[model samples]
Target: MNSLIRKMSMVITESLMSQRTICTNIRFPTFLQVSSPLLAEPMKKKKKMDPQIIKAREERKRKRIEKSIKKLEKNTKQLKPIEEIDWPISLQKQKLLRERTETISQPQQGQDILKAWRSYKYQQSLQETKMIDRISSSQLQALEQLRAISEDLYIKAIQMDDLLLPFTAAGPSSTPPIIGYDVLDGEYIDETPKWK
Candidate 1:
């Protein structure tokens, strides 16, 4: 009876252990079975090329590159001509007609004329300088008078007027503004002559 009871208990324990293991496994979900489309397809076979054909292709590429380099080198030797810098062919053809051959008859007369011109220019410059000085002195005197009258007014006058920035002005027209007149829009035509 003891041996039978022992055998029955051992069987019951083994069944219970298996049940526990199954319960434990069921408690946790299995990992997701992830797969990629790229991995599913079979690998492609590489094509075998001839060595001589490969060398010929390489040689052709090298020759094409060398031909382009030679073309660039040829072009580098010749410079592009600029129209503005080079004398015009029309002007060069008329060079003989434009030449002056006349010589001065009296050098002393020329020197006297130059001296007179220089004196006139000097006098004009002196007059301009004196006028500028007078204008500046008058401005200073006016500023001093303003300061004497009111320091605040003088200070305000000295400060730069920011409102006058990006200054734009329209000149007075000969005709007066017409009230409620409909102005017609005209197309602008450039009449300037084109020079070659």
Candidate 2:
């Protein structure tokens, strides 16, 4: 009797499964006809990219680059050569010292003046003198000391004058400040008028 019930349950389940409906959350893809004589209709062709569209895109890119280059050229000024630079008063003194090093370094002539001049020149330019003849340790130290001396002297000059903007005072000013300057609080001050 148990064997008969098991057989009946299996048959009933199989029949119930066959009778049950299927439900899908999404619609199925419409399959285009591939080929036909016995099955259905004509074959579908794959989509091809147009060459005219690709050529047009490349042309647009070329025009954009040329436009940018033309705009840059229009906005920029012509560059000047290094020799045309008019150095600061401090640098002019150094340049003269460097140019007249032989005359200045003669025996019994003041060697200290040339050293002081070099220091002044170094501070005026705010860079190293690239002379490399392998001098002794003492000479190297002296050169460094001269540089430091000039820098300290520059600071002292500023203190004596009651000055502002140390870098502008030293280096060859790329953009010289006009008579008036804007303060931190948006007020303009005439720097020409000495604050006594």
Candidate 3:
């Protein structure tokens, strides 16, 4: 009878411990679920950009890319002819030409030789000026185009009272309450808070 009593007590204690463990496991998950949202990371909000500003930026980027591509094409075209120049033979020919030019331009003992040298020097200077003009021709053309665009923009600005031009023909060329002021439109309604 003593052995049976001891066995029964041990079994009761084991069953109580099992029940407590199962209850704690269920409650632990519920507690975590309740607090999870409070402890969770916050979501980041996306920045809103103006459509007009984004469109203008994209247009500028496109123009820049086109300009760069044009420049690259021009550079490639120039490189093709330059690649044909045989370095060794060209260098030798250039040296010989320089020697001949120098010899012709040198002032000798005779006055006739000095006169010829002066004429040669004058001719060389003329050639150099022509070469400089040729080199600057493309730059001058670009400058003229820029000036024309500037003048066109300036004329448009002067013609319009407002900076922005009216895109639609229905509206007045010059916009706002200044050009087409109507009595019905609430232009002068003051919204300042009255003192109590």
Best by lDDT: 1
* Per-candidate RMSD, Å: 27.3, 32.7, 34.8
Candidate 2 local lDDT, 1-196, one digit each (tens): 9999999989965764565534343365333333333766668886786989989999999999999999889878856447658567798778856675345445545677778899999886653333333345656677577667797755544454434535434666488666676556666776797768
- Which wins on TM-score, candidate 1 or candidate 3? 1
Which candidate ranks first by TM-score, i.e. highest? Answer: 1
User: Backbone collision count in every prediction?
Assistant: 0, 0, 0
What is the Cα-based lDDT of residue 139 in candidate 3? Answer: 63
Q: Is candidate 1 or candidate 3 better by lDDT?
A: 1
| lDDT (Cα, tens digit) per residue for candidate 3, span 123-176 | 999999999998899766766776678977555444647536655456557745
lDDT of 1 at 158: 89
CA error at residue 28 for candidate 1, angstroms: 99
Predicted structure 3, TM vs. truth: 0.23
After superposition, which runs of candidate 2 have C-alpha atoms over 4 Å from their true positions? 8-46, 77-196
- What ordering of candidates by lDDT runs from best to worst? 1, 3, 2
Each model's C-alpha lDDT?
Answer: 0.85, 0.67, 0.72
Ranking by TM-score: 1, 3, 2
